[model samples]
Target chain A: MATISIEHASKSFGATEVLKDISLDVKDGEFLVLLGASGCGKSTLLNIIAGLEPIAEGTIRLDGEVVNDVHPKNRDIAMVFQSYALYPNMTVERNIAFGLEMRRISKAERKATVREVASMLQIEHLLARKPAQLSGGQRQRVAMGRALVRRPKIFLFDEPLSNLDAKLRGEMRTEIKKLHQSLKATMVYVTHDQIEAMTLADRIAIMKDGVIQQIGTPQEIYSKPANMYVAGFVGAPPMNFVEVDLVKQEDQFGVILPAVLKGEPKNYFLPLPDSKQLETRENTKIILGLRPEMITHNAFTQSTNPEIECDVDLLEPTGADTLCLIRLAGHPAKARVSPLFACDPGESMTFSVDMGRVCLFDGETEELIRL
Target chain B: MANPKTLPGANGKRYLFGRLFIWTLLLAAAVLYLGPIYVVLSTSLKDLAEIRAGALLDLPHELNFTAWREAWSSACIGVRCEGLRPYFLNSVIMSVPSVAISTLIGALSGYALSLFRFRGANIIFALMLFGCFIPFQIVILPMAQTLGYLGIANSITGLIVVHTIYGISFTTLFFRNYYVSVPQELVRAATMDGAGFFRIFWHIMLPLSVPIIVVSVIWQFTQVWNEFLFGASFTSGGSQPVTVALNNLINSTTSVKQYNVDMAAALIAAAPTLVVYIIAGRFFVRGLTAGAVKG
Candidate 1:
């Protein structure tokens, strides 16, 4: 296992900087995923960590040894590219054994290792076939097997499943997770697929415009995104932001939320949690972040939790949960309700907001105001 | 069902006639191209008296290897009459080393230009491509001077050096264009596998280079074999290649033009390239088309 520490790394191509002041430390055996959209420097960062690309600034350490000047082969790392990057001319057996052969391993030992890796990947039946003959899923497995057979100090994966179909992507994703679990090798995966990031990463580093926005556990990123970008980027049905005016209700502080009742828009006081940020921001505008699941189709009776009756502008049923779009404070927001909840478009319904899970951000800076 | 053949408005008949006519034209064209070769073969097999008396297309009354033997051993080339045999060997010696050395270095250089990202790499490749456009006539004077300075002027080694230098740009172009389609990930994968530059080229790049190699080999072979300018300009006498020898054999003033002997020598000079094309012709086309289409 290896611990990768990237300190203040920056990379510039010509005049444009692709990675700016990036620092990340991956613990031993932890599966860290660099997640971002295209041109966000996620792939560039992964290439830097793999030593495929050189860094213009800062140093990279693999297991406490500075490896910035080391050749990729000497870094003791193997990477699975998004394209699978299987040596096309070599058969599955030779492809797996090539690394061993290069290391001057004995012929018999290379064969045995290849056989073991082939069987582990369940590609033994395909050992004689070339890469062109394999299906997309099989190629992905072979790519993984190539990385696995080496058993390097670290494994780097650059969107290894992005080329597969949806069904195969899911299967290969689980296989990768299982492989990581069994081997417990330090893996740094890069992908823009948030679901892949969410399900596979021990810690997800959300990046944007060559900068790391936040690096934390998946749950931490989901529940407490550092800013508006992370909050909107991580979830499938992204977090909804509503412009609200903070007001004081005697000793209590809350926002005046617009709700629809009896086919008419009306104002309701949604009490904010008791916090210094809220008190300081009273009488000023702030952005409120709410997840789809945090608001559900439920009737509030005794609880003092904030609830609103709004018209369902649109309804989307996704087998397990039906997402109902409603307007809240002049912006469209998604509310996740059970599929059995009979909500129709243009009909009014009550959605209970979990006030404890709500996030408040400074109006101008867009950074979360933690209290 | 209708009687399809007779029930038609004669369109099927017209279609058959059209196809037949096209085939007839293709056959006529094929014969037109092969007609000269047939004459050369027939003439080379006949006695000089018969060749002079009979029409070019007439069949020889007696097929013989007399001219072939004379051309291979004792036909006159200039005053020596040592025939084209020594010059044939000279051409073989020159072409083989030229093709091998140029192709090897070209493949390595092409792999570097295609896969590696070093500073000035593209500038170097651009310079080499500029070599492809430098007409031989434009540099022959400088080349002769250089060869004389190196003490290889008028020598077989000088001819080999000239052909190799001239062949590199084409060979490099062939291999580079063909290898550009190869993914850089393969190199990265090899590098990660602890395979260094030469190791990667040997283990990975060379294995995948067969088609392009055949293309390069055939190209260099044909070019160096048929090359009269450099062979004639760089060397003379016994060191001259078979093409230069063939010209001298046909142009000798000491004897009457021995058409049969000259024809035999000409065919012998062209034999190796003919055999190469007939053997690896398909791969040549494949390489060309592969280079044409982008991945």
Candidate 2:
């Protein structure tokens, strides 16, 4: 296992910069994922680490030794491509042994290693078949087997499961997670699929516009996002934001939401928690970020937490939970409620807001407000 | 469309008539193509008296081997009575080595052009393609002088060099167009696997080149075998190819025109190319169409 440290790596094509001043470190035996949308340069960064693409202005180190000038084969790394990039002319056994053969390993050793990798990937029965004859999932297994036979210091996967169908993708994702667990090899995976990043990464580095926005554990990224982009990108039914004026209500600073129920408008007060950032900010506009699950149908206490009665504009039932859409402060907000709650459209329902889980952000800068 | 095998017997007459029309057209096309070849073969088997007595379309009363035997050993061309044997050997000696050397160089050049990126690569490819548009007659004089400078003038080696140089532009075009369809990722993957330039080419690229090689070989064989201008201008006597020898035999005014011997010698000169085309006909078409559409 190797620790990969990238220091201020920047890349550009012609005049347009594709990666700008990016720095990241992957610990030994750690599974780190670079997550972003298309053209965010995550794939380019992975290529740079794999020595497939050249870096413009920074140094990369593997296990504390500079590898800026090393070739990919000499870097002790193996890569699995998104297209499964299997050699079309070779049989599955030959494809797995190609790297070993290139390294000039003995024929007997190559055959034994091929058998071991095939059995590990459960592709032994497919040894005689060509890549074109295999199905999509089978091709993915052969690709992984080709990488695994080398047992390189690091494994680079470039969206290895994006080509499979939904069910197969999930299955392969779990299989990859298990493979990482058993082997404990350092792997740097690149993908635009957030669910893959959330499920498979030890740490997720969210990127946008060729810059790393945040690098944290999945739980940290999910519960305490660093910026507005991370908050909006990580969750499925994304976090809701409403513009509110911070006002002093009797002894506490809070915001009021205008809710409509039964053709009548009511003002509901949501008191801000005791934080140093909220001091001396009265009469100023701020944004309140709330997750969908935080606002639900359960009412815990009448006096401690704030509750709003609003008309449900839409309901989407996903069998496990139902997402209810309601209007708050003149914008659409989604709230996740249990399917047992049984709410519908055009009806008024009383929902409780989890005041402890709310996040406050600066309206102008879109940065999370914290003490 | 309905399945014809499952159709009723009552529809058989209409199907028969449609097939009959197609067969009639095909028969007319075949005769149109093969009529000249048939005349040459039949003429080569007849005596001078039979030629004067009968129409050109009439079959010989009795087949004669005298014309074939004479063409093989004793037909006269330019003060040499020794038939087409030597000139035929000269063409073979020229074509075999030329095709092999030109095809190897073409494969290497095509591999480099398709896979490697360097300054002015596209300009180089464009320049090579320009060679295809130049007519052979335009370069005959300058080429003869160049052969003289190389000290291979009027020799079989000189003809081989001339054929190889001219044939490279076409063979390179065929292989380059064909290799362009191979994915660049294969090369990248091979590089990452520690396979250098030549290893990847030998193991990965060459195995996949059988069809295009067949196409290149057949094309080069036909062109070099039939080439008369360069052979006549650049060489003399025993070094001239069969095409030039045949031309001299047909036009020689020193002896009475032996039409039977002339026809037999011409057919003998044309046999190798005909055999090549017949053997590699399918691969030739496949390689041509694939190179055109994909590249």
Encode model 2's per-residue lDDT on B72-153: one tens digit a residue.
Answer: 7888887998888998998999999999999999998888988775667788889999999999989998998999999999
Give a tens-digit lDDT track for model 1, residues A74-160: 888999988887887789899888888999999999999999999999999999999989999998988888898888989999889
**Chain B TM-score in candidate 1, rounded to 2 decimals?**
0.92
Name the best candidate (by TM-score): 1
**Model 1: residues >4 Å from true position, as ranges?**
A259-263, A299-302, B1-32, B291-295
Q: Which residue pairs in model 2 clash with each other?
A: none
Which run of 10 residues does model 2 chain A get worst, by summed lDDT?
A298-307
What is the fnat of model 1 with respect to the true interface contacts? 0.69
Q: Which is the leading candidate under lDDT?
A: 1
> Per-residue lDDT tens digits of candidate 2, residues A1-371?
59999999999987989999999999999999999999999989999999988789999999999999998889989998887777877899998899999999999999999999999989999999988899999999998998899999899999999999999999999999999999999999999999999999999999998999999999989888888888899988889988888888898888887777886877899987877678867888988889998788864434567888899989999889899998888889998898878477889888989888787778888888874
Clashing pairs in 1: none
Tell me the spans in candidate 2 whose CA falls farther than 4 Å from its real position. Answer: A258-267, A280-284, A299-303, B1-30, B291-295
